[model samples]
Target: MTSASLLPSGLRAWAQRQVGPITAVRDVSRLRPGSRVWELSLDGGRPGVFLKAASGVVAYQRESFAYRHAVPALGPQAAPQLVESSARHLALLLTAIPGRPLAALDVPRAARYEAYRQAGVLLGWLHAAGDLRGEHRVEAGEALQCAARGVEKRLTAAGDRVRAAERRLVLRLAGDLLRLGPLPLGFLHGDAWERNLIWSGRTGWVDFSRARFGACVQDFVPMYCTAWAEDPGLRAAVLRGYGRELSSEEEYALMCLSALDAVGCLAWGVPNGDHALVERGRAVLARLEAQAV
Candidate 1:
C-alpha cells in the first residue's frame, strides 16, 4: 500500500531504510486484514520483526511510550523491546513476542488465571516506576482527549443516535469523573482487554492505544472485569504485584472508573463493539452507587 494509504507516504520507505536495509512491504491494510503491522524479514535471517505504524490511535501511542520507557527498566519485567519506533505517528516496531491471544485460547481457567498473575507483575512494575507522572500525566491526558475528540467526531458521523448522544454524555462524565478526589495517577495500559494479551508459549501484551498516566484503576478494570467475572483474588494479586496493598476504597474506585470507561465506549458504539461491556459497567455502577450511600 502507498504511504497515504496508511501512514505518511515516505514513512514505510524511510523506516525500511533505517538501521538495516529494506526487505519487504509485508502488508498494507491495518484494519481490513493486514494493515496493522508488517513483517520485516531482514536480510541475514537473524529474526523477523514487526513494524507498527505511527498513524495508530492514542492507546497505540501509549503502548509505544510505555514500552519504550519500560524496556530499559523492566522490559523483562513486563515489557517488549523497541527495535524501532516513531512516536510521531504513534507507530512502533518491536520484537513481536509469539503468542496467540489469550482470549482465543480454550485454556483451563487455572491457566488463564495464571497468565493474569504474570501480567500483574508487569503492571506492578510499571506502577512502581513512577517515571510517568505529573507532566507525563498531562501529555497522556492530551493524547486521550485527542482520541476522545475523534471518537466524538466519528460517532457523530456514524449517525448512530444513541451512540452519538452517549459519546457526548460520556465525554462530559469522564471530565467530571476526572475531577473526583485526586484521581489515582499512575501508568495504565488504558485498554487491557483479553485480545490484547498474546498467549504464545508465553503471555505478552500486544496493544497500547490506551496507555496513559491516569488512574491505575483504568488498567485494572479492563484487566479484570472486561473479560471475566470479578476475580477479587486476582485483583489482590495485581495490587501485590505493585508492591502495595490496595485499600477497600481504592478497589471500589477502580470499579467506578471501569464503569465510566464502558459507558464512554458505548457512547461511541465501536469500542468493545458489543453490549456486554456496557452491561457489565452498569451492573458495577449500580453496586458502587449503592455502596456509596
Candidate 2:
C-alpha cells in the first residue's frame, strides 16, 4: 500500500509538519506487516526522511518513547534521529540512518565475532545509562512468569512424553531463576539480534518496537539462543567485550531464558509452516534439555 493509503490523516499531517511540504510520500516497502514505513520527498529539496506509521496504539507509544527517551541517552550516533512523534496518530518521523543490516554482511567468521563483541560493548553503554529504570517497567518475576507461560503453551502442543519432559525442565529452571531474588533491572532492546543492527560505516541500532524495562540478562536471550549458539567463538567475543563472565546462577538463568526463546520460536513457526524456524526451535530446545540433564 502507498503511504497515503497506509498512513492515517492525522499521521500524514504530522509528517508534513515535521518535514515541511511533502512533495511526495511513497511506500518504500513494508518492512513488516503492521509497520508502514515510508520514504518522503520534501518540496524544499532537502534530503528525504522516513516515517513509520505503527499499526497499533501501544506499539506507536513504545517506539515513540524509546526514540524520544531511551535511545537518545545512548548517544547521538547510537540510533536514528527522531524528527517528530505523534501520540494521536501513532506515528514517528525519523532521519534515515544509512546501513544494511548486520545479518546481511558477508564478513569472515572473525569479523562477525568482532561485530558481536562491539555490539556487546554498545549494550553495556546503554545499560549504564539507567534511564529506563523508572515507571512502565516489567518486574523480573513478572517477565519470567510471562516467559514460562509462553513455554508451557508451546510445549502443550507436543506429544505427551515430549511435553511432560520439557515442562518439567522448564518449570525447574523457572523456579531456580525466580529464587535468585529480584534480578537487576534495566532497559531491554527486547529483540537484540544481529538483524536489528544497521551496519553502515558505523553501527546503528533500530526498531525499538519491543523495547522495555526488564531483567538485564533477558536482553541476551535472542542472540544467545540463535547466533551465539551457532558459533562458540562469536559467543566468547561477545562475552569478552561485555567485560564479564556470567556467574553460575546467571548462566542457569540464561539457559532458562534461551529455552523460553526457543519455545516462542516454535510457537510462531509451527503454525506458519516456517521449516527453518521450526528446526531451529527444536535444536535449541534439545540443547536446553541436555543442559538440564
Candidate 3:
C-alpha cells in the first residue's frame, strides 16, 4: 500500500471528493516513475476503484467518451464500469474489474488461444456498436487519404531513426494502401494489444486512451506485431471469432499499417529510452522484410 501523502495533492483531494475516504492507495500503472494510475480502497468496505489521470485534455475526453458511449455496449462483463469523471482535473474514476492482463499471464497454448478468441469477439461487438461516419461525415477514401498523409509525415520525421530500406518499405506499403479502394470504417479500440486485454475467468478489455473513429484494420496493427506474429494459429482464431474475413484490400492495409507502426516504435522508442520497444520494432520490420523477399 502506498502512503496517501505520496500521491499528488490535487489527485488525492479530487479522489477523496469523488469517493469519500480512501483507506489505501496502490500504484498499478504499467509505466513507472511518472505513472498516473492508482487503485483505491474505500471506507465502508465499498468496492475498490481505479483512478486514471489523463496526460492531456484530449486523452481525458476521448477515454471518457468511449466509456460513456462505446464501452457500455460490450456489457458489464466485458469492461470496467465508469464511476465518474472530472473534466477539470482530467481524470476518471472507474470500478475495478478483476483479472491480470493476458500479456502478464503464463497459460497453456489452448487457454491462450481461447483468450484471443474472446478478445476478437469483444472487439467485433465494439466495432458493431456504431460508425463515426454519422458524426464526422468524412468519406472513406478521404479519411484513408488523410491517414496515409499522417503516416508519411511520421515516417519522414523518423528520418535516420529508421533504416533507409525500412523507410522505403513503409512508403511502398502506404502507396499500396492508397491505390486500394476505400475501406470500411468503425469505432476502434486503438490500442488492442495483449496488455490491454484482461483475463480472469474470461477476457475483458481495458484502457481506451487511444480509442477513436478510423479504419477498422488500424485496430489490428498492435496485435499483428505481438500475438499474431508469435502464432499464426492465434491470428486465425481471432479472425474466426471476429466472424468475418477481411477483404483483400483490407489485408494490404493491415500490412501497411503494421509497417508504419513498427517504424513508429523505433522513432518514439529511441528518444524515450525504451530499448525493448526499439527491438520489437526491429523484429517486426525484419519479419515483414523477410515475407516481402
Candidate 4:
C-alpha cells in the first residue's frame, strides 16, 4: 500500500527514509487498543522489523528514551532491539522478536504458569542490572499516594461497604508503607501485566513507555493479585525464579500495592465500560481486604 495511505504523513516518511528504497508497510496491528504497531517488509523479501508509533508526542519521547536507555540493561534478548527512533516524529523501528504474547487468557494453564516463572526470572535479572540513570524516579511514598488518589477518586460511585472497606484499606496500607521505611529502588516495568510480555525462545518485555524507577516489589504486585492468587504453584515458582521469598516487610508492602492496583483497575474499567474488568477488580479488592486482616 502507499505510505501516505498506510501511516500518518510524518511517520510514513520517517519509516520509508529509515528502511530505504522499496520499503512497504505490509500489515498494521494494535498491540493494545490505541497502541500502534506495524509490520514492515524491506528490500523485497528480506525479513523485516516491527514499528511502534505513538499518537501523542510525550508518549513518543518516553518510549523512545526507554527503549534506548532501559532495554539494554535487561540483557541482549530481553526485549526487541531499538533500531531507529525519533521523538519528534513519534515513531520507532525495532527488531521483531518472534513470539506470541503471554496473555493469561490465551495460553494453556501449564504454559501460562511456566511463563510466569520465566517472567519472574527476567524481572530478577532486570532488577539486578544496577540502577538505570535518567529515568523518572517515583519514590515509595509518592507511589502509594498516587495509588491512593486513584482509589479515592472512584469511591463516590461505590456502595457504602466498598467505600468504607477501601478507605480503611487505603489508610492502613499507607501506614504500612510508611513503617516499612525507604525501600530498595530500581527500574520498574511500570506495566508488568501478562499482556505486556511476549514468550518466544525466552520472555521478552515490551511497551517501555511506562517504565520508571521505583520499589522492586511494585513490579510484581499485579501478578501477585491475579496469577499468583489463582495458582499457588505459580506463586511459588515465580518466587523460586526470583531467588528469594519476600521478607515480612516486603510482603506487607506488596499487599498494599496489590490493593491499590486493584482499585486502579476498577477505575479504569468503569470508564471504559468493561463490565468483566470492573467485576474482576472488585473481586480482587475484596480478596486483598481479607488478606490484610
Top candidate on lDDT is 3
Error of 1 at 242 (Å): 3.9
Candidate 1 vs candidate 4: the TM-score winner is: 4
Which window of 10 residues has the lowest lDDT sum in candidate 4? 132-141
- Tell me the whole-model lDDT of each prediction, alpha carbons only: 0.58, 0.72, 0.82, 0.70
Instruction: Give one digit per residue, the lDDT tens place, for model 4 in 1-293.
Output: 54433656666678778876536665555433566777877886766887787768767765776677667766656687788998776788987765777874466667766777778887787665534444344443356555545555655544353566676776577556655666666667777877778887467787777666677788888677776777889888788777888777778788877766666666667767767667767877788767665
lDDT of 3 by residue, 1-293 (tens): 44632667788899999899999988777663334788899999998899998878888988998899889888777888798999988999998777899989899999899988988898888876655655544632365566666776777766788788888888888777678786877777888988899998788999988887778787888888887888999998888888887888888888877787888888788878889888888898898899982
Number of the top TM-score candidate = 3
Off by over 4 Å in 2: 1-10, 24-32, 132-142, 153-162
**Model 3, 224: alpha-carbon shift in Å?**
0.9
**lDDT for each residue of candidate 1 in 251-281, tens digit (9 for 90 to 100):** 6455445445555544544453656644655
Q: Which candidate, 3 or 4, has the higher TM-score?
A: 3
TM-score of each: 0.70, 0.86, 0.92, 0.84
RMSD, one per candidate, in order: 5.5, 3.0, 2.3, 3.5
lDDT tens per residue, model 2, 210-236: 876677778888777778888878778
2 or 4, greater by TM-score: 2
- Those runs of model 3 whose alpha carbons end farther than 4 Å from true positions after fitting are 1-5, 32-34, 131-133, 137-143
After superposition, the stretches of candidate 1 with alpha carbons farther than 4 Å from their true spots are: 1-9, 19-35, 56-64, 76-78, 87-90, 130-134, 137-180, 228-233, 270-293
